[model samples]
Target: MDTAPARDSAPPRTTAADARRGAPASRRPVLPYLLIAPTVLALAVVLGYPLAGLLLLSFQDMTRRELFSGAAPPWAGADNYRTVLTDGFFWEVLARTLLFTLVCVGVTMALAVPVALLMRRVDPWLRAVMAGVLVAVWAMPVMVAASVFRWLSDADDGVLNWLLGLLPGVDLDKHNWFYDPWQGFAVIAGVVVWGALPFAVLTLEAALTQVPRELAEAAVLDGANARQLFRHVTLPVIRPALVLVTALLAIGCTGVFNEIWLLRGGRPESDYYLLGVYSFIESFAVNRYSTGAAISVITVLLLLGGAVVYVRRLRALGEIE
Candidate 1:
């Protein structure tokens, strides 16, 4: 007892765990903030600064000449915003973007659900093969895909025209796909949906695995067919994942440019201009930086609204707090 007391009196040595548990109240909270400060500072510099500058620029009159020259840009309070917002061209582009997003999301979800469910019930080898294909497509670079799409859709001696020529009563050799707005937009929608499906299918498959098979089995035993079982059982379980994917896809499709640009075949006067392309043209091609910034701000607001709606729906369904 004397020896023990003497040892105890020597002062308690701090272990790693002890240090963590016994960290001073003042230091503990500050330590976490200290650790995160670097990341926060980096993000502020990289993302926040640019976004703040864009917002400020949107409120100013930044013309092409001032953009090129070293002269200070003139201030035009809400003028750029008003000009961009009131422009008929901007609204048309925005409408096209929204329509494209709707088509892409609708088709992607429709195909992804079946594909995901199929992956669960398929043979091991088949499932592996399918998953590999999806992962490969999902991992494909956007630039590479765009390049391939450009090659396939080329006006002169393109594969699409060659294939069309093979069909009876048709001769589409060297046809320009971007000439017709509807046809061009439809083709774009197809490509976007194809590229987008892999991600949705893979995500849904992962989410489906978390769902209890017992519920599905119980539903099947109660005289429920495949459609009913999926409707009543699997739908609820995967609804959250579905909603998340929808929101992500909506945001992504709204800002899609690479594939659309490639499909548009570099035609500056093409009627197939979506919001993304319009913004690019204004900012870079026309050097209307403030107008482009205003468009970007509107796009951000649209995404925020989509996110808000997603959260509200999910909350209404009691999927999240």
Candidate 2:
């Protein structure tokens, strides 16, 4: 018959979404991975290789000889680690580093939180001024700040000593702040906190801006005092930022070296050794590259552990998805 043959039924076409749904569960969107591929590759080339090399170097008995001669260092296995771990001095330095970190982080948070809260309550112009000042401080070079601090706490003719000398019965002129490790660390901690404050304060302030006015007013309507309002409402809103800043501060403090190094004229005494300083001294000063690499590896492990804990905390708080 001349009638057209019945056309065969064609398969339904699928859209991208449909294809995604029909795909195996293990298959994810490749676009995201593709977009990130360049970044991952760059990091692998820059940071990953160095980190891997450092790890490998830690297991070798590298020294000045191998470094200058470009010779392969002897395989040391765990000998370098054992030597560092067995040293009482290393333990002392670790303890000092931890203690210094605690103090710096604690003081920074204490000062920053209050300043941030103050900013929230102040006039907009005042807040702007404060923010400008903080930005300026943050923008200042670390080297310049450290130099200024060193000059201030100089053993002779220091502005700090001069100011203290102004106080009746206080004779701090020509005082050697570095003579006492405790006092020296106090100055170092001060420098750290000063440098850290701007970031913490600005971060907290930004977080504060996100606090719902409705919630704050609601709390006030519920007869909540300022402290209670903060405890129940404000703190919850800012808690994520607070935790982040505190974690960063802790990590930064643990790795402090520049301030001490500059203040002590590049030859910091045993009393002034933090983990970073200790690593540098072992590697460069003592010419024990393997030992330094081991120390650095340990420090990295500790930092990684802290970061894991921080991530878990964020997840627990529902701050991270």
Candidate 3:
């Protein structure tokens, strides 16, 4: 009776390989790589080619004349690099660049994150108004904001000086904010930080909203103080957004030229120059194409180093894990 009740033979046991073989063509692991191949190729053509050319150009003794001439660029080994690296001016400019990038990133993030947090606690209408302002500020074009800030700090009839003049014994009339290098850097810092703050605020605000309110309540119920609650609960949840914005701002600020150029006025001294400005002035203004290329290469390397540090920081915080 038991033999008669035996079930039909089961299907063959499928191994991983067999299962993969049975999957749709599009579902195969290699399909995504295939689909992205064209995009990768296009990007290589666009970015990789130019970067390779820049690297090659950096090692050669190239100039505007040599580039335009019907001859190959001269091979100079590390002459261009030596010239850039050994120059006292380049180092000074680099220091200023680091200072500028750090200040802008630090000040912007410090103010923006707090403002974003406060927005969640405020009345909805006030929060709406605040968000609108941030959006409007963020939407303003870079050049427009730069130009506006330039006008605001104008030596003659600027609104900032106008307001200062109204206060008793505090007439900042016709104050040339960009006359000194430190002061010029300060003004540029102000403009850059202000322009960047709104985006940071919005990013943090979105991240803050995604954090579960229950975690905060749970922390409070466990007798966590205000500082402890934020440090333990809120900070970890939004750490990813914080790291992302910080890295992005650091990278963007490292390449800053437009704001400095517009705000500092044209052809500022080495004291006020950042790496990008230095590269531009060396390449175009002074016709040192090879030197500029070397500077560009150095800047790229520095940025890569920064990116590595940022990644390591995130990993250390377990954000990446």
Candidate topping lDDT:
2
lDDT of 2 by residue, 43-145 (tens): 9999899999999999999877888899999999999999999999999999999999998999999999999999999999999999999999999878888
Ranking by TM-score: 2, 3, 1
Candidate 2 residues lying further than 4 Å off, grouped into runs, are: 1-28
Tell me which of candidates 1 and 3 scores higher on TM-score: 3
lDDT of 1 by residue, 1-321 (tens): 345443435667788557545777765567768999999999999989988998898888888678679687888889888898888888888888888899889989999989998999999899999999998888887767767776777789578888888899998877887678777777788778878999899999999998888888888889999889878888888888999899899988998888877666565453777777888888888888888888888888888899899999887776765
Query: In terms of lDDT, which candidate is stronger, 1 or 3?
Result: 3
All models: lDDT?
Answer: 0.84, 0.92, 0.87
TM-scores for every predicted model? 0.83, 0.89, 0.86
lDDT of 3 by residue, 4-47 (tens): 67688999887866764566776669977999999999999998
CA shift at 191, candidate 2, in angstroms?
A: 1.3
Positional deviation of residue 209's Cα in model 1 after best superposition, in angstroms: 0.8
Q: Which ten residues in a row have the lowest lDDT in candidate 2?
A: 16-25
- Mark the 10 consecutive residues where model 1 has the least summed lDDT: 1-10
Supply candidate 2's per-residue lDDT for 19: 59
What value does the lDDT take at residue 217 in candidate 1? 82
Indicate the residue-level lDDT of 94 in model 3. Answer: 87
Q: Which residue pairs collide, candidate 1? A: none
State, as a TM-score between 0 and 1, how close model 3 is to the true structure. Answer: 0.86
Flag clash pairs in model 2: none
